[model samples]
Target: MIGFHFSNYDPRQSGKSKFDQLLDLFTQLLTYTSGDVTEALQWLNELDKKYELTDDEYGMGDFIDELKEKGYITDDEQRGEIKITPKTEQSIRKRSLEEIFGKLKKTKTGDHQTYKPGLGDEVSPDTRPFQFGDMLEQIDFTESIRNAQINHGLDSFTMQEDDLQIRETDFKSQTSTVLMIDISHSMILYGEDRITPAKKVAMALSELITTKYPKDTLDIVVFGNDAWPVEIKDLPYLQVGPYHTNTVAGLELAMDILRRRKNPNKQIFMITDGKPTCLKIGKRYYKNSFGLDRKVTSR
Candidate 1:
C-alpha cells in the first residue's frame, strides 16, 4: 500500500485537496487492480470511511463523476459499470512499461532492411530500362531527347527504349523472433522479484515489433515446472512459482508453436536466470540440483 502527504494548508478548504489525494489513490489502486476505475472507486469509499472523511470532502462518488467528466473513465449505463477509457489504458500501460523496462531498442525483422550509406550491403538505387507503368520522373531526359531526335526527327518527339529508366528495389530478408520468459521461483531468488522487468521487456518488444517492423512476430511465454502462454492482461499479477526451471519444456513448446508458421526465417529467444533443473519423466519428476545437467542441456 502507498501513502500520501498533505501540506499544512487550512483545514477549511481541505476537501479541495481531494483531487490530488484521489490521483495518488488511483495510481496505487492501478498497481493492484488492472486500472478498473469502478472497482477501485468502490474500494476507495471504504478507505475514505476508514480515514473518517468529512461530509464536505469529495467522496468516491464525486471522484468517479469527475473521472467521467474528465474522460479518464466512461460509464456504460446499459452495462451498469464504469470502465477505463482508452486514453487512461494507454497511459497506464506506457507508464508501467517505462517504469519497468526504462528504454529499449526498436527491433525490426522483414524483407526491407534499413539501409545506411557506406554499409557493405549497400543497395544500388540506380535505375534500369523503364518498364510499363514506370514513373515518368525516372526517365533519362538526356537519353530520351537524343533518341527522340534520331528516331522521330528533331521536330517531332516520341519516347523510346533509350528514354526508359526504372527504379530498383533492394531485397534483404530477416528472421522474426519470439522471446519466451520463465516466471519460475528462481527468477526471484532470495526475494529479488524479476517478473515486473520481464513483463516490461515483453511489452516493449511487442510494441517495437508492431510499430517498427510491422511484419515481425513477438510471442511471450512464461513457464514454471510446466510451460504455457499468456496475454498482456495476465502479466502484472504474474507471480513466481515454487517450481524448478523447465527450459527444455519451454523451448520444445516454443518450437512447436513456431513450426506451423510459413516464414522461412524464424528464431526463438529464451531468457532464464538458472539452468533447467527438472524434467518430466513419465508420471514422475527427474531433478538435478547440480549445475547444468547434460541431459537437460542436450534437450
Candidate 2:
C-alpha cells in the first residue's frame, strides 16, 4: 500500500532508479527493525546519506511522507509510536511471496494432485483414453466419433478404447496447511540473523496460500519452549526468545489446529536448523542442549 512510483517496482531489472534501491533496502530494514517504522526510517536515512541512495529531488523525507500518505503505516494512539498498518503487512506478505516463490506458476487450484476426474471448471488441454471409472461427461463424444470414423473408414464403425478420448481436468479441493517455524534462541544465536529469513519465507508461503489458493486454510505456529499460533500480520515482528526448542509442542499445536479444519487435504511444513532440545511432560519442561537428545527427538 505504500505508494511509490510503479516504474521503480522491479529492482532486479538492469536500470533501477534511486527509489527502487531505497525501497529494496527499506524492505530488508523492516526485518531487523521488527516493524518499528520510526526506527526503520532512521536507519534508512542514515544509509541514504552514506550511500547517496536518494537524489535531491527524491529524498528520504519524501519517501516517509509517501509511506504515511498511502496508509501503509500509522501512529499507534496508545503507544504514540509509528507502527505498520494492515496494508503494510499485506505488502510485506506479497513481497515475500515474490522473493521466495516467484518462479512457481500460479495454479487455479491447490498445489496437490487428485485422482478424481471430470471435475473443476477449467478444463485441461490434455486427454486420455476413456477408462471404466471415467464419468460419462468426461468422454469426448465428438473426438471419439471422429476417431472411430478414421480407424474404420465409412464401411465399418465400432466404439472402442482407441476411439474414446476422455478429457483431463484439474480438480479443486480445499486444503488445510500448518506451518511451524522454529523460534528458539538458537535461531538468532551464534551472531547470525536466521529468524528474519525464516519469517520472510513463512510470510511468503502464507500469502501464497491465501491469494493463490483461497479455498485453503493456513495456520502459522512458532515454537520455543511452548508453541502458539501467530496471525499473518504479526509475522514481520517475529523474533527468537531465550527459549529452548520444543518441537513436540509445535507439532501438537499444529495437529490440534489442523484437526478442526474441514478440508480433507491436510499438510504440515516445518522449518528448522537444530534438533529438539526440550520436551514438555504434563506441564513440566525437560531441557537439554549439550548434544542431540534422543528423548526429545523420539517424541
Candidate 3:
C-alpha cells in the first residue's frame, strides 16, 4: 500500500521565485506611489533593507532588470526616468481583481435575472397556460403533453391549444454603474492609507465589469473640492489633495454619467470616510470642515 506524508510548510520553500515575490511587492508599492516607478522602487529598496528581502544570489538590481526585460517598465536614459508601461497598468488591475474577488466561489456565467418573467435565456420553473402571443419555443412540451393526456384519453389521442403550457423565463438585465471615490485630504489623514485601498477597489471593480460582464457599463468619478471622471487606466495614479469632501458634487456627477447610459439598471457606488463638508454653489465653494454643516447636508 502507498502512504502519504505531511510536514510543516515554509514560505521560503514556496514555489514563487524571488523575482515574482519582489514584483508583487513592487506592484503594491506602485499603487501607493501613484504609479511612480522610481519612487516605488526606492520604497522597495528601503523595505528590502529592513526585511532582508533579497539574498546575495538574487537582488534588487536583478529584479529591476527582469522588470524591464518583461516589458513591465520602460527606462528613458535621456530623461533618467523610469515609468510603468500599459502592461504594468493592466497587471495591477488583474492583481487587484484577484486580491478582491479570489475568495468568491465560482459560478455559472450569466447576467442578473429579474423576478419579472419575459423573453430571456434562463428558463424559470413557473409555468402557465399558453397565451396567444407567447412564442412557440416557450411551450413546455413535456408539460403540454401531460396536459393533453389528462384532457383526452389515450384511445382518442387529441391535442388542443388549451392543453399547451408556457414556461416563463426570467428577464436578464444589464447595469450601468458609476463609482465615486473621495480624494479629499481627509482620506489620507491620521497616518492611515485609505486612498490605496479605494484605488484597488475601483480597479478591481472596473476589471470585473469589463471582463466578466461585457454588456454592463462602468464609469469612475473622483471627487475632491470638485468631481470629474477618470479613465480606468488612470486609477493607479490617482492622488488625494488638500481639498474638502464634496459628496454632493460626486453624486451629481455620478447621476449625470448614469443618465447618458442606455441600460435600464443604473446605480451609484460612493466610497467616502467623512461626511459632506463642502458644497459648490455658483462660482464659489461653501466649506465647513469643522463638522457636518446643516447647509451642506440639506443640499
TM-score of each: 0.61, 0.81, 0.85
- On TM-score, who's better, 1 or 2? 2
- Sort the candidates on lDDT, descending order: 3, 2, 1
Give me the runs in candidate 1 sitting further than 4 Å from their true place. 1-92, 96-124, 133-158, 171-176
In order, candidate lDDTs are: 0.65, 0.83, 0.92
Pairs of residues at least 3 apart in sequence or in different chains that clash in candidate 1: none
Q: Which candidate leads the pack in lDDT?
A: 3
Judged by whole-model lDDT over C-alpha atoms, candidate 3 comes out at 0.92
Q: Model 2, residue 19: displacement in angstroms?
A: 4.5
Q: What is the C-alpha RMSD of each candidate to the true structure, in Å?
A: 8.6, 6.7, 4.1
- lDDT (C-alpha) at residue 40 in model 2: 85
lDDT of 1 by residue, 175-267 (tens): 567678877778778877566566555555555555556766666677778888776545444566788888777887788778866777788
**Better-scoring candidate (lDDT), 2 or 3:** 3
Candidate 2 achieves a global lDDT of 0.83
Query: Candidate 2 residues 58-167, lDDT tens each?
Result: 88878777777878667789988888888778878888888888887866654555656547765777888888888888888888999999988868778788799988
Evaluated at residue 109, the lDDT of candidate 2 is 53
Measured with C-alpha atoms, the lDDT of residue 285 in candidate 2 is 95
